[model samples]
Target: MPATTIHLVRHGEVFNPNHVLYERLPDFHLSSRGVRMAQATARYIAAHSGLNHAAAVYSSPLDRTRETAGEILKALNSVREERGEQPLELTTDERVIEAGNEFRGKRIGHGDGALWRPENLRLIRNLHKPSWGESYDHIGQRMSDFVYEKVGEYPGEQVIVVSHESPIYSFRHLMETGSAEHWMWKRHTALASVTSFTFDSETRELLAVAYADPAAGVQ
Candidate 1:
């Protein structure tokens, strides 16, 4: 049986001049530099022999993810056209979205007024389960389910999934270490990076995992 590959891609930087945690908020699109980064990522994937043959593309419903996926689709379609093949369809999956955060819209800097509030301080008690918002296990489970479903659907082919930083990193950590209890400070999933996984075609078990920053040095 042939192996199947899935690429979990993190979206580019957001246009947040305020530097607030946009977590699941609406209208938060990618910045201008982020658009360039997205384009560069798409080009990189299109040029990659292993990933350019992706059967389908999926992304989160957020604006940033949608925009990033659109750029990827465009680049992938260009490659398909060059190769005389049809373009793959793009779909949205809510399960692959950013992890929910109770601190949404609140500035977390040292001088920020919201960071020093008594109620906000109380929410920081648990870093393992993360009391401020969604638990790591929850995000890992949903991401795992999504990956299983997609790998099953597109056996022996590649599937591209565009998602946020936390979900992608959490799922990658779980797959790599078999544990999702680590603190967020350890993860360094960069913008427009690709974290890939290969699975057994028959058993659907994870066979290998890899990471790449296609848009590296493209700040």
Candidate 2:
């Protein structure tokens, strides 16, 4: 049984100049620092993993993720071509989207008096009830489905999933370690970092999960 090794990447920093909750905002490109972060992540992946064996790449449909995936491919392509190898292309998957934060489009606080307000978080925690948006449970179900399905299909291969915080966090929570209401607490995913999971082929279950950050353990 071959190992289903997947490279799950979070998208790079968005161009949130105001730094507001730019949820699902279309056309948000990578920040300058974000580009560098993507490059760093790509370099790390290239150095650590095998490009030729990577059968496919999967990413969120969002532009930020698409851009990030491109950089990873570029890194692999550069290193591989240096040694005379062809580059890999990425596939877009809707499964690994940003988890639906209930307070997606709404302002965190009044425009001038803006900050990470306590009330805003309260709103996000109870989002499943209809006043807000999708619940963490709802998001988790989708992520679990994606993880199982993707791994099943690409057994013994390497894949990349680039997506936003919510969906990816749901995946982490499902695969790494987290509860249903964990997102309610204060946890923010840094942009363009890589999160990976290695699954046991015989059981098709996750053997190990890891993140790039050394200081931060699983959220």
Candidate 3:
């Protein structure tokens, strides 16, 4: 039986001096340290024989995810060059993009335009369901559709997907527990972390799930 593995990688830290919620916002690139974080994770993926063999690299259609995917492509391409294989190119997908948020441009402090304003609190009453923005079910469904499509396209091969925290964790949580409703504060999807799901190509059965935080020590 042929088995396929899809590694979902979260984007590195963003260069947000104002610390505003930049969800799906334009021009929010990676910070200097964030670049290093992406590099660290890229090295981790390149050093692993299985990961270096990934057939395709994918990213959310956002600056931060694209930047992170760029670093991984550089490292993976180097390995491919050594192996006489064609270098992989990146494909950005909206399905794996950041969750839509009403608090997109709000800060987190106790200021006038902060995220914790009384008006904002009303929308955030249920942390698990998230009434303020995109629902967890929608996020999980989109991610699932993306992964299943890739599995069909690359059967038995490996692929890398760079995305945001909520999409990654929501999808994984859905796969693990059959429901995407999860505590936001309890998300284990760190920046530049890799969460892999291995499946039976013929049956599309999820065989295993694994996670790694290569940039945990970057700070």
Query: For each candidate, what is the lDDT?
Result: 0.90, 0.69, 0.95
Comparing candidate 1 with candidate 3, which one achieves the higher lDDT? 3
lDDT of model number 3: 0.95
Q: What's the number of clashes in each of the models?
A: 0, 5, 0
TM-score of 2: 0.80
Q: How far is candidate 1 from the true structure (C-alpha RMSD, Å)?
A: 1.5
Best by lDDT: 3
The worst-scoring run of ten residues by lDDT in candidate 1 lies at 107-116
* TM-score order of candidates, top first: 3, 1, 2
Which of candidates 1 and 3 reaches a greater TM-score?
A: 3
Candidate 3 lDDT tens digits, 1-219: 999999999999999988899898899999999999999999999999899999999999999999999999999999999999999999999999999999998998888789988998888778878989999999999999999999899999999999999999999999999998899999999999999999999899999999999999997
- Report the alpha-carbon TM-score of model 1 versus the true structure: 0.95
RMSD of each: 1.5, 4.3, 0.8
Q: Could you give candidate 2's per-residue lDDT for residues 104-126 as a string of tens digits?
A: 55554566435456665555434
